[model samples]
Target: METRYNLKSPAVKRLMKEAAELKDPTDHYHAQPLEDNLFEWHFTVRGPPDSDFDGGVYHGRIVLPPEYPMKPPSIILLTANGRFEVGKKICLSISGHHPETWQPSWSIRTALLAIIGFMPTKGEGAIGSLDYTPEERRALAKKSQDFYCEGCGSLMKEALLPVTSGSASSQADKEAKELARQISFKAEVNSSRKSVAEPADLSGFNHLPSSPEHQQESTTLAFQDTTPNEVSENQTNSASSSQEQHNQPASNNTSMSPRQRRAQQRRVPTSTNFNQVQQPRVNTNHMGSNALILLLVLALAALIFRRIYLANEYIFEL
Candidate 1:
């Protein structure tokens, strides 16, 4: 095998050591590289006892890459294990399906251990997985031993028995628990992260609390600003009232000549005149003085005429 590949290549040497170690430490699974091609191997596995797959002997093929030990191998079950499809690549973290998770430290023995250990668990629905009932799986398991591999040139049961003198059931059960623990730990971590990532709802709050002193200050300033406006309004109302009284029609029109009445009509203030008052006008001060004098004279003359009329009426009655 070393003569075909680079005799001193790290990958080739590593596979040779892994093959030797797999024969001694654990014997429930046995593997041998093809005589012609070192990169391809055939494996035989004994199923765990007291499970649906109890007393089962399964055969499979393992195809390693040129960069193997650096790259993971692809595993295909040739026997009808009922947990996986026959003659198809099995999807596992240690298999070629998850190259990112595979480690160089992991060897053929590690993968075989994981495969048989997970037989009793439910299918992950991954590629090559099956969901046969326990009864169907047990029936298939009983017939797995009769399966023969052309490359290995031996029955499945004959290949697995020579490797193990101890109980295959005890070792498989121990590995199964370890694998379950690893899966549970990962699930718990994911649930905790989801809870922490959830967002909080804050749409219910509209107003926030403020200091009492700040509220008092705001009210005081508002009152101060409005006081001048109220004063200006009162002043405007008083000015309007005075203008109305002055513009009122003289009670006795007989007191004023037609020319004077016409002048009064022309001088009567309009909305236009009120708006113009806001503008700066030339000679307005003198005009205002003349108008005041004319009002006083008319008032005095009306009083005199009223008194004379009353005295005349009094004499006529006598």
Candidate 2:
């Protein structure tokens, strides 16, 4: 193992340390790197108590990546416990399938504990998951003890040490259970939000009115808004026209009969009334005629006086 993997490398060093720490199996779990490969490990985990998988001893494989703690490992169940398919890599938040949720602080022990905590949960149709009934699961739990792996041998029945109360593994189990619960809760919340938001988006499109109906309503509102202004404008125009007619002189009333028209002409000023108003012009013409007659009389008097003077001169000469 030393020659195959560089001991100086962090991944190799970390795995070696974990191997040393877990050399003695706990009552609930046991894991160790294979002699041929430091990156591949074989583990055995006892099922959680008070569940269908209780009393089951299951074996599995853990294949670590070159990145080690920076990346997560892939888990494959070798024993059939009815919750996951045998020999298939199972998806878990602590597994390689969900590296985004894995933390460098988590170790192989944590992964095993998480698996135990998750066994009682519904599979929810995930890859490598199963939804066997309680009766089936309980039957399979009893059968898991005899399951064997070529690499790990027939140690599945006695893979773990006898349970000791108040051991450190019990505390680690509690922490693993809490971590699993948190991961499951977050996944449920995300799914619920997506389910709600999808319908809201679709309903937004479903409730929209058609274009023709929207346009007709807009047109009706536009007419209603302008009606008062149009009516006020028409009233103002009519008032102004009536005021103009009241200020100016009246024209001929075609609606009146001939007698009514004559009566109106007499009552109000007309063209014949304008002739009566020209009486001063006639007086002015009369004054001019009187001045002409005075000039003609003066000329006749001068002519008679000149003829009498001529007659006296002739008598004197005779």
Please tell me which predicted candidate would have the highest lDDT against the true structure: 2
Residue 53 error, candidate 1, Å: 0.2
Off by over 4 Å in 2: 1-3, 164-173, 186-318
- Residues 1-318, candidate 1, lDDT per residue (tens digit)? 344668698878977887777554234677878778777888877777678998888888889988889999999999998898898998876689867567787788777777777677777798899999899989999999888888769686667544443656465667755764564464456557645643211111122127776456444443454677785885686687677677675724678755565465444533433344435444558888677567656666765685576567656756
**Model 2 steric clash pairs:** none
Per-prediction TM-score, please? 0.54, 0.57
Global Cα lDDT for candidate 1: 0.71
Judged by whole-model lDDT over C-alpha atoms, candidate 2 comes out at: 0.77
Worst 10 residues of 2 by lDDT: 268-277
- What local distance difference test score does each model get? 0.71, 0.77
Model 1 clash number: 0
